[model samples]
Target: MESLFHPTGNQHILDRIDKLTPIKLSEWGVMTVSQMMEHCKMPLQVVYGTKHIKVNPLIKLLFGRRAKKQFTSAHPFGKGMPTAKEFKVNFEPDFETAKRELKELVEKFSREGKEGIKVTDHPLFGKMTYEEIDVAQWKHLDHHLKQFGV
Candidate 1:
């Protein structure tokens, strides 16, 4: 699995991200291109500790591992998957700004490495190791990038 912590993996994601344009159309899901860019920032915000997701213990116990496996697995996320409320981009976002911010966040995530990542519990997938988080993040970016047909 590719990881954001590795330079090559980070560059691969960045290259994919650069392919996105304001007029890009999603092959699936409800987000506009700009909204999708903004939506992409949510997970990084969580990693950076700017966003705190409260995980319900019951939910984690019931679904965490399953959810984690889905995200970290080689198989891609199916189209029109359910999104968490916090990840829903509700407002209009400036395309250029959203793109720039997401790119910066991706760069920051790559530069941070393991020591910079926060050890936080995912809302649906309990406590995760840095490696798991890395796989999940890359898979997420790949999934969305593919969604936009980039």
Candidate 2:
């Protein structure tokens, strides 16, 4: 797993993020550029603070399996999984503002690093390691960025 704090990984991910434009359109996903920006927010919300959704047993049983495997491996997310309800942005988002927010959050996550971390319940995945969290984070953004043909 790439450490969120590692210079190479952090810089590389940030570079991809830096390339986003307000007018960017996805070649695949339904989300617009701003929606993609908001989608990026979900992982930041998980890391920077509390994830509002509590872990339920059944959800943990199903989504958790794929989530665990996702983190443990470098494999990119394939299309098909249901998008989280909260992350489904519907309103028009300020493009420049969203870009600014995305860049800042990635920087903050990198600076924080993985140290003495505790497992947190994901909306889908049950519990995730700090390493898993970092990899999951990078891969997710990478997937969407590629979706937008970035």
Candidate 3:
């Protein structure tokens, strides 16, 4: 899997993000480009301890590992997958602001690399290693960027 920890993969993601514009429509899913950019930041924020998502205990126990495995695997995320409510952007976000913020976060994640992740236990994914986090993060950004047809 391409990892954000690697320079080339990181730059690829950043370049794809730059291709997004305010008027860009998703090839699939309901998020506008700006909203999708904002949504992308949520998982990274959780890694940095800047955001928290409360997962149902029962749900986590039942499906967390399986979901995590699938997410971090080489397979790309399918279109129109359900997201956690916390990651949903209900209000409009400024396009440039969201783009700038997402790029900044991506850069920060690349700079700090695995050691930067403050949380190893994902609420919905149970325990995760640094390698898993890198794959999951890259996959997520790739999936959303593909959504915008970038």
Candidate 4:
């Protein structure tokens, strides 16, 4: 599993993020460049503070095991994360700001280390540990980065 807290992994993603431009386009999903950046920042938003979260009991029962694998494995994420109502960034956000936010959040995670890592009630995954948080952060970012050939 790639730890964003590690220098190499952090550098890898940071470098990729730095390379992003408004001209970038995804190879798979339909998100615009701005939306993609907003998406990249979602996990961080969840960690730093809640923008929006909605986890219910049935959701926890269904997604709990899947969430566990995400914490410790190199498995690719399923298409589309469970989005929170508050995290949607749909106003044609500024590309420069999105890029900056993405880099900043990742850096915060790197600086925080494992102790810094923590997950709360996901809108779907219920109670998540930092382990679960790391995988989702990495996997989701990786998927989108690859989508844009970053």
lDDT of each: 0.86, 0.74, 0.91, 0.75
The count of residue-pair clashes in candidate 2 stands at 0
Q: Which pairs of residues collide in model 1?
A: none
Best by TM-score: 3
- Taking the tens digit of each residue's C-alpha lDDT, what string does model 2 give over 1-150? 465578777788788888888777788768888888877876777666644655667877877797679656877788655676767788888888888888887777777666423335566766676767777888787788888777
In candidate 3, where is summed lDDT lowest over 10 consecutive residues? Answer: 1-10
Give every collision pair in model 3.
none
> What is the C-alpha lDDT profile of model 4 across 7-111, one tens digit per residue?
789889999988888998878766888888887788777776745566667866887667756644777866765555556666788999888888988888888
Task: Give Cα distance to truth, residue 99, candidate 3, Å.
Answer: 0.4
- How does residue 109 of candidate 3 score in lDDT? 78
Instruction: Give per-model CA RMSD.
Output: 1.3, 2.3, 0.8, 2.5
Better of 2 and 3 by TM-score: 3
Give the better candidate number (3 or 4) by lDDT. Answer: 3
Candidate 1, superposed: residue stretches over 4 Å from native: none
Candidate 4 — what's its lDDT? 0.75
Order the numbered candidates by TM-score, best leading: 3, 1, 2, 4
Q: lDDT per residue, candidate 1, 56-147, as tens digits?
A: 78877988899889987888888888887778888979999999999988888778787677755777887888888888898888889999
Residue 47's lDDT within candidate 1 is: 81
